[model samples]
Target: MASENMEISLPLELHPFVIRVLDDPDLQQRLASIVEAKAFVEESLKVAAEQEIPLNAEILASTLRPDPLGLGRFTSAPLQMDNWPPIGWLPTRTVQSQDGTPAFDWVWFGPHRHSRPFFEEDVRRAEAMPFNWLFRVRTGLQALISGYGSEPEVPLKGLIFHMSRCGSTLLSQMYASVPDSLVSSEPEPLGGVIQWIRLAKVDQESAITVMRAIVAALGRDSGTGAKYHLIKAEAWNAHSIALFRNAFPSVNWVFLYRNSIEVLVSLLRQPAIHTVENLMPREMVELNDEEPRSREEFAALVVAKIGKSIITHQHLGGGLVIAYPDIIDAATTSIP
Candidate 1:
């Protein structure tokens, strides 16, 4: 089969220091190999597109859209994994810390010979990439479709929106304990789907595809006689309610809020999480010189955004507001 033309452009200019390092022949060769692998992956996707194969939600969410940074450069050629390391190049993994403590793992695959922990900047870049957004949309769509048609013994009650560290996870776990209920915690598909929604040129078909996939997956997971599928997404995805409502108008929504100060304090203390980049204004950063203060302000702004989003959707009906304290108490009682 003839290969389709595939191109991915990087969002940021390469740092001068990094550019100089690429002068080395060895590094250049390794980088070329990585590019080749990306091309091979893209080719395979082209074939799938040509064949009109339905993509699973997980794959759709991660790969279809053009990355903002143009890093969606997977190869269409077959990969020769025989010589690669057994662990191979999987997306970042969570691993134990050097001190034997539990820590979030941040791994990457590239031409660079040495492996080091990714910093906040690296994560921000990854999140901005178009491919990452595409992957999320594809995956969420697949999951939704899988869950939709199955017999729903239990009607889906509603969805909950929250800020991170606001006890949302705890709340979701609690709701899962209801008889015949299913709960999906911080599923990756939502993130991918939302990324596509944020693009200037939105594709309604793609959005519908994703929403259907998530709903279907939820239904299937809940089983034939099960009740609701409570989906708890990452705090950053609070805006997803808009997309969800667009696709499934009748689905109810519940937005959760907490004390801004407390939420900020909790997020800053965590390692391996990305700090704000393009989202925050320069003035906001300048006012809060300290990292903690900056993080607090950022969290406050994000929470405000989430609140506004809820309000915007409230008029449509079936939206509720839940306090963090109430949610925590509810979770404690609900979870077995």
Candidate 2:
């Protein structure tokens, strides 16, 4: 087979570094090696397909795989695995296939102590899945087509939104504190769906459908007396309020924000990924019709956008608004 030099375009964020590396012959050789390895994998898979080897979901589920990030080589069956680590598990991220279909990769967690925060719990998960690539799993594509059929204990209890630096994590910790609550703080699959929806790679209808399935998948009752299923989205998810509501209209929603300066300070001390300018699409950023020139300005714009979303949603008769200071009190009284 003849090999052609493939021109790859870097994302806007990477263009500067990419330009610097463009002239490096070593980099070019490394890129070519990647291409050659990809071609080898494709040819191997093609030979397997020609031999009529089984590549269904069941087989894929049991087999070990080297390419965790690639979806094209697998069959259509959606991926599922048993014997997930003791603390329960969650999808780490979603990847799109050549056809633009999304698939999730699940990560297992170690035991989580009752009093531990989400970050600590995550640390436990990472410990359990240590150097995860060493122990691999094959995932197929049909799972989504066949429907993973993740059954929720009951329907989702509600959605949580917030401005960056607000105590949404603490709020999620409080919810997790409840013996019967299943609180998923920013599962990556939902974030992927939101991005897919915004990019028009996935339609609103399909996005809603996938969102419901994901919530259900994550909302498992496990006979553990889990009554309330709460999903805390990424802070900037305020931008997609309507899309989410469209998916689960009856699910109550709440937006949490702090004083502007306090929020600004929190962000300045440690910035969230979404606060980077041009990181999000223009429509989603909603920077008050102004382009921010600096990181601080971008953080300010994001905070303002979140506040505006909450107030706007409140006026639209959608959901409750909880201030940062009153989170505990509001949770005690307002949240049902």
Candidate 3:
């Protein structure tokens, strides 16, 4: 066994050929050697386990934790070739992951995890699952999907998209009441993927891959006999209707809207970040920002654009439309 602090020396002249080895045919040979090395390493681990050495406990008990402060990948020199793609859920941001990669970072949230109800408890718990501190595990996305060896959780019971201030939360709460249903309301990572896809100009195929991995990761059965999984998306996510529909075409969805006046008034009383003037893309809204409207007008205009996007999706037969007043009836009758 190698000593804990034993320093291993390497040939200084190997630097020039390092890139050649990384980018050439010998890479296959190098990969094969790594596989052999890992087998020996695993054998050592097995021996250690047989001896009851508790070798991993120190690292496991400390850094890697459930409800980690964030998730990220290792991306610096002194490259850890032995642990390529060293991604994990971490209890702190002390170690930064590769920035601008097709990856995600998560922070713990409490309110989202509320437990019981029409779907209130279920949605709250599932949405908050990302924030829960539990034993941590890390795997590359492709490896994760390959290990599953099957298609992702599909035909999710339904999706709920809304114009803010509508009864979206109430609807999700009701769904939580259903027996064995898991409701994920406004999950941030899912929302982030949409933004990343657009702002990062990520290709559609890669975006789909990332989206599938995220939903699959979060879509695990809640171990409470959950038979249905419902996702309530963020309000502005209505704009990404095409991408979302393409990803989950079979999933039934509802778009909830309310009176523009009511939405504007609600925003005025309790402002949200999105209600600020010019907060959204100018190309998307063509707003007259030079002579901005009052906060209420700006809020109303944002709501109108969201409603218009939802309506377009509905008109194209991607989802059903329900006015705020009709949500309860629609929920009781249409949703199983």
Best by lDDT: 2
The TM-score that candidate 1 achieves is: 0.48
lDDT of each: 0.43, 0.57, 0.51
Report the lDDT of model 1 for residue 277.
42
Clashing pairs in 2: 76-141, 76-142, 77-142, 77-143, 78-142, 78-143
Range of the 10 consecutive residues with the lowest summed lDDT in candidate 2? 1-10
Q: Of the candidates numbered 1 and 2, which has the greater TM-score value?
A: 2
Name the TM-score of candidate 2.
0.66
Q: Residues 294-327, candidate 3, lDDT per residue (tens digit)?
A: 7766777777778778766675564788899988
Using TM-score, rank the candidates from best to worst: 2, 3, 1
lDDT of 1 by residue, 1-336 (tens): 001121122222212212322234333233223223345345434534454543233443333344343232232211111111111122221222244321111122222211111122333444443323322111112223443454332344556677667667666656655555655555443444455445423587766765564444333431223556556655555655667777767776666778867776776676213236445332322323434445556555655565666676677766667778787655444322
Runs with alpha carbons beyond 4 Å of true place in candidate 3: 1-99, 105-155, 277-291
- The residue ranges of model 1 lying beyond 4 angstroms of the native Cα positions read 1-156, 221-225, 271-275, 278-296, 328-336
- Residue 265 in candidate 1, Cα distance off native in Å: 0.6
lDDT of 2 at 92: 49
